[model samples]
Target chain A: MDRQLDQLLSSAGRPALCQSVLPALLGCIADIARTLRTSHTVALAGTANAFGDDQLNVDVAAEKLVRDALAKCPAVVAASSEEDPAERPVRHSRDAGQTAEEASSEQYTVAFDPLDGSSIIAPNWTVGTIVGIWDGASALRQPPAERQVAAVLGVYGPRTTAIVALRVPGAEAACLEVGIGDQDFRFHVIRSRVRFADPPFATRYFAPANLRAAAESPSYMRLITQYVGKKYTLRYSGGLVPDVVHALAKGHGVYVSPVTAASRAKLRRLYELCPIALVVECAGGRAIDPVDGEEILARPLEGCDDRAGLVCGTTDEVDEVKRELLGASLESCR
Target chain B: MDRQLDQLLSSAGRPALCQSVLPALLGCIADIARTLRTSHTVALAGTANAFGDDQLNVDVAAEKLVRDALAKCPAVVAASSEEDPAERPVRHSRDAGQTAEEASSEQYTVAFDPLDGSSIIAPNWTVGTIVGIWDGASALRQPPAERQVAAVLGVYGPRTTAIVALRVPGAEAACLEVGIGDQDFRFHVIRSRVRFADPPFATRYFAPANLRAAAESPSYMRLITQYVGKKYTLRYSGGLVPDVVHALAKGHGVYVSPVTAASRAKLRRLYELCPIALVVECAGGRAIDPVDGEEILARPLEGCDDRAGLVCGTTDEVDEVKRELLGASLESCR
Candidate 1:
């Protein structure tokens, strides 16, 4: 299984940076998946994150696992997590005395949402881990399109699977779907080149996140009505990772999390949005800012807590969302 | 793990019938879960079922596994499945020559949707197996409230879990949530008495299936608007088993599959609706026919192909759905 992942990365022209970082990110994901399956009872941690969201025991544990794994990777100089928003220096055990400046030249940074859907985990629903690997000492103040080298969306569902997107400096960008074996916890390539379904599908699917935003945004509400009228299947799981991964797995679908005045978007750009956008774009889909209707990858990460509304999935469906949600206002401006 | 399940059933006064049937039913479910986790590739069978829904290779395999397992349970005299919607006599190995009439005295019948969410399975999303155990040679022409002795909803998700509801003739009805261990494939009781969350929850959830029906029924449309307007969390997964299971796991949610002129209900009464209704009701929730707003358990199964709209979940939420969807018309009639 590991061989398949190695082959996929090699075919995509693996940079030395990804070679050091991917294993650490994926290893933590595997550990988390195993822990989730075995630990039947997940308790509330009696604490909240910086964002004031309550943390589960599993969430805290997963965040630690990710941090610990990244600390072992010599090339991963800095990392930020959703649970802990501050970007911290990751000092490898082998190079304990290495200064931040000395490591800056060949260093990579990571931003991860260790456990993305903790709200739904108590119910034993499928959650996920999102990791974005940036080719720098830190991910701050840089657009994902320019700095993000690879991203992994690890899905903990009926089967542990991942959508890995690699965009090294020189090679062709690739998105690969791999399944983790229960016994070995190793990833085996499921689909080497994951892409959205060719257009004109018989039944289209949509995952409309933050449906509460509909009450405030008439356009968002109308878009949902249009989708229902068109007989598009609804597939929201209340988890950003699974919802977006659905589009990648099925090869079709749209996932929209709109930010309205009444319902502010909560998905962080550094930990969640950028990683997801990288994977979606790599899969031949589109990921865009819901407000401006621009590619999400083009947005720069201002800080660890940067949040945004996302409209992502099949290219045409995303285009349709932008047109329906922003068309009237844009036309009025014109 | 098995001990926990045995204890749960024993506490509910396990009828000699469930002793033979439960093991067989759950064994098949565990087998299916294992198969689902391991099978990396699932292909289309290139054929459709009696309902004209395309079947996947995994779906076909699951149906056969269920039938084969039931064939070993001497007490399970007959069985029917969604794939093959005809009642067939299940002949045990030791009782190969036993006539259906001879076996009928102590026999139980089984109706199952071996794989409830084949459409979403291709996306590597969580799907499930639903089994309803009836205390008779056949399940036709009897209400689930009287005939359904036990029901099991096997969830194949990030963690393999099952909600087992037992309603034998004499003992108190009980609902249990159990997790299936990956290694041993044994059932471990997670929640012994799975009940809906106590009322007055801060955040309510709703899974509105067949959203297309919203276009045909103004009442259904208004109900959805009310849910969104009231800020109910959307948790639909386009899969019946997981959607309903979410309600059980979260302890507060409603799943509505409304039947209208445009969107006819597809959930089979014998296989899908009855089992789910049993589990929900056992969990102190309510399961009702969406049109009449009556308890779903009271409806008699006319045939294996009988299908109906279901509004089930937290008791109060189910009541709210009925009130919103049927209140105006009822008031007009009054």
Candidate 2:
């Protein structure tokens, strides 16, 4: 009755490092989900994180849980989180037994956003966790398409579920959706190979984030107007995780978070955007920067605080974004 | 450990009829929540409802459960649902023991949308059940403010919760938010009294339903433009129940569904709109028809197929909806 996450990872031929790191990460997410059900207190801790967003007691608590869980994984040499945007050594004890060079060769680094939608959590709306696992000891100065081997998105909604994407260099890319049961809290595979619906669908959905940016960018406003004019169903929840997850679940959706002068991009590259990009690509969808129309996975991490706008989901819809937001501008110059 | 729904109703000075009827209704909703967790099938039943909306397997299952539960309640004389838009007799067994007049005097009627947001349920997103209890044998030929006494909205999300609104003829209206625990599946009070945030808040939210109508109605389009320009956070989930529930939980939100020449109103009055209107009004918010600027509760429910657009939430924002979508047209005459 219990379909463990490790079994699924091993059967899918994921890297040994991923088989070990992701389960530990999910364990922490499951614990956080349980705590949220009973904890009624969402009082502000009166402190800000590295990003300057005010910290809630639950946010800080979730970050500690994720950090503690990663520290237990021997293969996780270093980790960074949105709450604390610094790559700190996870298992310092390993330095005593092995040389730094030897440890760095085999271990992996993780960057995560422990709690993504703290603003919506107060209303008991869905929130989530995003984790990106890289192949080396550090996740800096390289594009996500290079060393990012795996990613897991933990959705804490009506049901506790995770969408796992694995891309080891030699093996086939795979996307799996799994759910945690309330009775035993065990992960059971829901969809083994998740993919966006093939084109020519009867209906389409859109989640336009950073809506205020519409006032600053005429192109972004045009995109929103186009989606509504085409009779696209709107399904935004004002949370990056749920908005994207909705696309994965429904088999067709486009989520846009545009960067404008008055409204800077809020999603961090290393912690949030890169991880979600991996999942979307593995699902046979596309993820790109809405402004430049470049692949998101091709963008370098640079630092934990690097932020970018994203346009991702089903391939055709994402292509339309480029046509309206990017191509339209190119043609107007003529 | 268990804060039963009956206890909450009795303590709130609700009528004896509500105390007996609401508990039975919640028991049905809780059962539906459990079914949703384990059921993976979202196949179409190959049938359409009275409104021509396709019926999914889960939707049909939920409607049957609600009908069966109401039949077991001796004091529920009749019931109607979105799936079956005709008022039908309940508890016919009472006819054997008592005369028709005796049964009619003490009994109540119920109208419900057994499963609201069925379209979103396929993705495992949060959907809900809405039930409104009326004072007589039929919920017809009367304004909701005159006879509707109580309502319950069962939210099937990461945690099962219900927002109960009770407004007996002479008693103070009460809106209580309660949660159903995993261990016992019993309702416990989360917020004893739920109300919208007072005006002059730092942040505001909006959920604009039926966005397709924007193409036909310039005022509706203008309303959305104004909301985005004013920096209102968009939190729409394309579901009426969760959209309104978000407003109650966040303490400030305006949910608008406007009717136009091309896009008629989709929300049902008896099964969907009235129940939510009662809950929103009890929470110190306002619910009104978007086109006419009339109070939703004041509209007479002529039959089971009644339909109307809703603009409900915090007092000021609902007022703004009236101003932008209605008042602007009035000003144009000058």
Candidate 3:
């Protein structure tokens, strides 16, 4: 039965690639989730967050699961992120002419933005885990400037979805499309959050983006301001993984590029969320070019690389952000 | 030095008391504090708290520490709380009621509130932890309601303090009181958060008798209120252990006892903070007794135990409350 279930989920993502490892990933994810649930539910009376630090408060089992996976898969050279720099193999002292055996072994590096938007843990906000795999040999040889990534994947809960991006032939040619919302993710396109054709746009706006881009986009800015004025709910997570996870789950998204804002600069990414974009696209959604649709944007090295505006929803809704970028005047959906 | 520190901490409390096991408790506290400082040094990535949840995110080190202590202490009967209900032995049980030689051993049951206020993990709130030690034999008995605890202890940090309670005698009650701001504390009088210059004066004001007591006793209330609010930064741990620890560190204090509008019941204790009042008094903090300063009040299981409006804090403040309850106007202290 276990083998059959594995075959089913594996078959769900065809071509017998790493998808064959779906069962293993799922098992790890489940183990971590259950461990986390138990820990929180039964934490000692006064003990909170498990550790005094906020980042360490993340699912301890989640970190262990990732660590275990990395250790077992000799294919993995490094498995860690801003949340965990400990996973980086320590370099033995060469000053003393240390032998090769004395030096730590190099393995595949799995860089991650672990538990992005974890600040929402207190209020139970949407959070996510993302891992980007880079080639061990190349990663070690290249300077900080030249690390190329092979694959990136992420998962989120409430309704767990596993999104992956593989650098296969015909991949990374264009701006990625994004698909989010509902279990039945049959993809469709729409222009923007506002639709002169759909039900009047009456909900509050809550996406993590640069305040500057949000202000520049007249439609989104007006909606956001009005929503804030009405004292409607607005939550912005400066972290990328969680922000995007939330946007997809909710069906309508908004992100501004070239933010020119200090606060939003932290959300910039080079090679990360693109794979997530691939997953979104596969699900029949669109990730519009933050800039001109014609010129494919390269991941920025220093800062705000993918800061171009991002809006994902049904294909048509996201097109609105694209339309606005293209000098297209949009009628208010309301 | 480690042994000396342990001996110094264990001196006043019962030698076999759970609180006497100061090594693990203090070690975990320092570990948490250090982690918090390191993680929060830069722009904090996410919310973290001092405590860890056992059910949601188990801390292997913490579990091992508590388990080791429970095993070494025979005086402990059955410990139970948010972490575990059954009295798991320090050693594993044999399978299916078989002797150890006959089958694989079963896991021991250890009940602990590994880390409380776990909700703080997400929003970056102050968290604390508690562990109540009981004998395994007693734990194997019936319901938790039937078990009698020998000692309950707690640690709350970022203003580190150890608060304890024990049923044993000749135990010079002590509290690890690290004065906030000043960072110096020793055994001292308890204090309150609400006070009134005179009683009966505010009979028409706040609903409960306790609030009225504060309104009535002007000078005493002022001292208690200021100490309660400014001293602890108005932090409340729904978890009993941290709250008790915080109170102990500040010479003892009180939260507003929840009172319904219609029932003019004199306040005996604050809502969630009530359960630990006995433990607080046992630790040498005064549990306000309207009629007496030294006595601790508990509701009679049967009949009208309706003693309303007690005071809790440093013994001095409690005495002050007792004086007011006797209808004497407070005398000014130089």
Deviation from native of the Cα of residue A92 in model 1, angstroms: 2.1
Q: Which ranges of candidate 1 are over 4 A from the true structure?
A: A1-4, A43-55, A94-106, A332-334, B1-4, B43-55, B94-106, B328-334
Tens-digit lDDT track of model 2 for B49-144 = 222233456778898888877766767888988888898888544323443433444667899988887666645567899999998888898768
Clash count, predicted structure 1: 4
Task: Please tell me which predicted candidate would have the highest lDDT against the true structure.
Answer: 1
lDDT tens digits, residues A104-220, model 3?
432345555545544333222224556655445323234322233333333332222333433333333111212122223221111112111232334323442544344345544
- Mark the regions of model 3 whose C-alpha exceeds 4 Å error after superposition: A1-21, A38-52, A57-61, A74-80, A84-109, A133-220, A223-258, A261-264, A268-272, A288-311, A322-334, B1-334
Off by over 4 Å in 2: A1-8, A11-15, A41-55, A92-106, A328-334, B1-8, B41-55, B92-106, B328-334
User: Please, what are the lDDT tens digits per residue for candidate 1 over residues B138-185?
Assistant: 899887798888899888877777888998877889998777776776
Candidate 2 C-alpha RMSD relative to the actual structure: 4.8
TM-score of chain A of 3: 0.55
lDDT of each: 0.80, 0.78, 0.37
Question: Where does candidate 2 chain A have its weakest 10-residue lDDT segment?
Answer: A43-52
Report the candidate with higher DockQ, 2 versus 3: 2
Which candidate comes out best when scored by TM-score? 1
The candidate, 1 or 3, that scores higher on TM-score is: 1
Q: Encode model 1's per-residue lDDT on A132-228: one tens digit a residue.
A: 9998888998867979988999888777778889887778898988777766667667787888878677668899999999988899999998888
